[model samples]
Target: MIGLTGSPYGSSFPYAREGSFYLSGYKGAAIWFAPVPLFDHSGVVSTFRQLELTKTKFGSIIKLHLLSLALLIVFSFIFYALIWKLAPIPSGAYPFVEKMWPLQATMETIWIKSTLPGGADVVGRLIRWEYISAGMVFTTLLYGGLMVLKAPPLLFYGLIAGLGTGAWIHYTLPTFIGAMLGKFYFSKKYGEKRWRAYAPVILAGYGCGLGLIGMAAVSLVLIAKSTSQILF
Candidate 1:
């Protein structure tokens, strides 16, 4: 049995014990393991110290990224509120629109539909729309927040990297997979319907546009970082 032990004052696990272990080291200063020697004690301690340093650096990076994300979320929320409040009101049949509609339109499919389909559908649609809208709003807000937050250049670059990752994983790949699935599953069912036949093409085009936007945003962010550094 290999047992792990951590430093009381540090985050690193510096000691490992085997079955029937009973060992001692410098009191309150170093850790000890007994019964089986899996590694050199001094070497293990050094390695643990290096790992601790690395972990500290990584933690700093994560904290910076999270700060940027939060800033983006707040900015996005404010932007959404402003847009919703300043936009024109719909007349007659259209109901009062909320601040989250733009985000919902981009992320939620049910909200894309014009007429209500059936029972409890409105409630379900609203819930999904709110959840997705919140996510989109959060991501978009973070993109702008990084600049205002005075984050490190690397942090801004990381945000762009994350956006690129999201565009490919969330938008482009899904669009491709959705198109393939539609062709495989619905081609036979709706082959004669012109709208159905063209749906995939339209979706693919939308995905391409979104992907291009994401790429442009990434390039702009990188360029801004470089220019700022050069000017300063």
Candidate 2:
């Protein structure tokens, strides 16, 4: 008889058991099983050994690790951009926004909880919203910058990518958009129903889009300063 053992990473079955098992997680699920025994007892063991070796190969493992790392970096950058966009930029006189961009982004994430349904209770939704918001911001910023820099092709690409991502997230994860739209509907139908309630959310959601505007303003200022210096 064959025995099966569950390791911290995966489940392993002895060569004698010619069958399969299943694995499940947040991302998805898969079935893992041993191939059918080909020969006598010794051959069966050898096949199992080969299968295990293939699974644990250094190159394959390394490739998977690198792919995971790349994905993590991409997601993190997107999240960072999103939070940065959501947070309020310090006033020109305050001098803090420029210094504490990351902190401001984090604070904006926290602020989102208050605005969301059930406030702090909906932690999952808050986290998802944060990611989605971040993605939106990053895309907008990239496209907007291209536009300001007079790189029409790059701007067009960015616009396509950003809007596509936003649309996908909106349609695929309607719960998030639904919550936001519901909030808007209710606010308009019941609460203050003024532009103020919607304006803050729009400003927060602008992410990279708003950043591009700031970038353009800075670029103009720099150009003006350079022209003045040249004239003098």
Candidate 3:
């Protein structure tokens, strides 16, 4: 709406077209950052998400925040339990947990600061069902493995989560660069008067091109898989 990433609702300058819902702009902004780690990364993004949450219905906002807090508590407990069970972590447990507590508390503070109105029905509807399903499956498998088999916690986090973190950064970097380049080029060419109007167009073009390429890639992969199965 305003950059490579969509702008928030009622955003200033080239104001985004109003959607049917009040949070439509906020939803766009959230989805724009969906590729990145939700809990980690830039404070700016975290702050933005908090702002976006404010567009949700008051009741639904409270519920979503509570749900997030509960999940965090459960994850913290699980991680601590795993640490307790680990062969070599007994001595380091206190220091590790102590160090992590501040971060956890800060996240809680951010979550609590958020407020919303008129967003109950759409609270969880923004995210795609497939993403929710996949997240559930992944969480179940990871926890099941850790609890049942006692897989090393570091191994799970380091390999899988680490890769995911890297992938999201990689996916987001190009778009960010494109937006910056657009800003520079537009400002230089159009001068102070008109640059802002065209900068966002560059970001839109990048997203559209990437979307087409991604779809084509997925289509090819599906076709190849089908053909291989038929041939073999």
Candidate 4:
């Protein structure tokens, strides 16, 4: 392979760089992306109108939402006043994270997935994600309905609703089975309190392991490359 300044080799790739790979997929989601303010009642009203939801119905939802927000603010002040809130980025780490600002602001993925038609599936899954709020409500109501039938065990209602939701069976099944097994078997063999304390550490270790493995594989490739050498 040849190396040249500014991809004078007539090719440049940025989205595939470290930490950018997965966030790169977000470009496909922005096909018609529109940035909106946090509280965009006009947009909601327009969507409801298009959906033919009665003004009264949407008005009720708006009222309920505002009421919930008010109650949240009130209860948060009352209950969590003692808790401290910090900026999302820590001062010490801000310098490192700030380096990605330009890339984060960009949208172009530059045909990274052009060869794979399945990239369209990624876009569809992302578009479907807009329904998460609705899906959650639907899932809750469905599970509650199962409860009204005097379902034998309440825990299994999750399996029913989760499967009913689009393509989440792969997710919900593993979680349900793992949680059941963990609570019934693993918690007994391994002390629950100790496991709870160590769970985050274990997950962090697993993530670091994956990152190291990827980097190691890339390092080996670079070492094996018999390319033109760079001089200091």
Local distance difference test scores for all models: 0.51, 0.51, 0.53, 0.52
Clashing pairs in 3: 57-117, 57-118, 57-119
Residue 87 of model 4, lDDT score: 25
In candidate 3, what residue range of length 10 has the lowest lDDT sum?
9-18
lDDT of 3 by residue, 124-146 (tens): 45447798599769867886778
Candidate 1 vs candidate 4: which has greater lDDT? 4
Residue lDDT tens for model 2, 1-232: 1222111111122222211211111121112122444443533565557658778675775697799999999988975675445445454532566668778666545444433445562334434667768867986787677868888553354345334533466543764565576577756675755655775577577876889999898657545533533454
Task: Kindly report which residue pairs in candidate 4 clash with one another.
Answer: none
Q: Model 1: per-residue lDDT, tens digit, 1-232?
A: 0112122221122223411121321222112222344643544565557658777575765797799999999988975565445435443212444445655554333322212234223423344567668867886787578768876545444344445443457765664577577767767666738658688598799999999999898657545533423454
Residue 168 in model 3: lDDT: 74
Whole-model lDDT, candidate 2?
0.51
lDDT of 4 by residue, 1-232 (tens): 0122111222223223322434444433333233533332334545566547543665777798899999999977853332223224424324555566546544333233422335533433444555867867876786577779877543343344445442366766786787787788867888898777776687799899999999898556544442456799
TM-score of 4: 0.32
lDDT of 4 at 116: 39
For model 4, what is the error of residue 34's alpha carbon versus the real structure, in angstroms, after optimal superposition?
A: 5.6
Question: In what order do the candidates fall by TM-score, top score first?
Answer: 4, 3, 1, 2
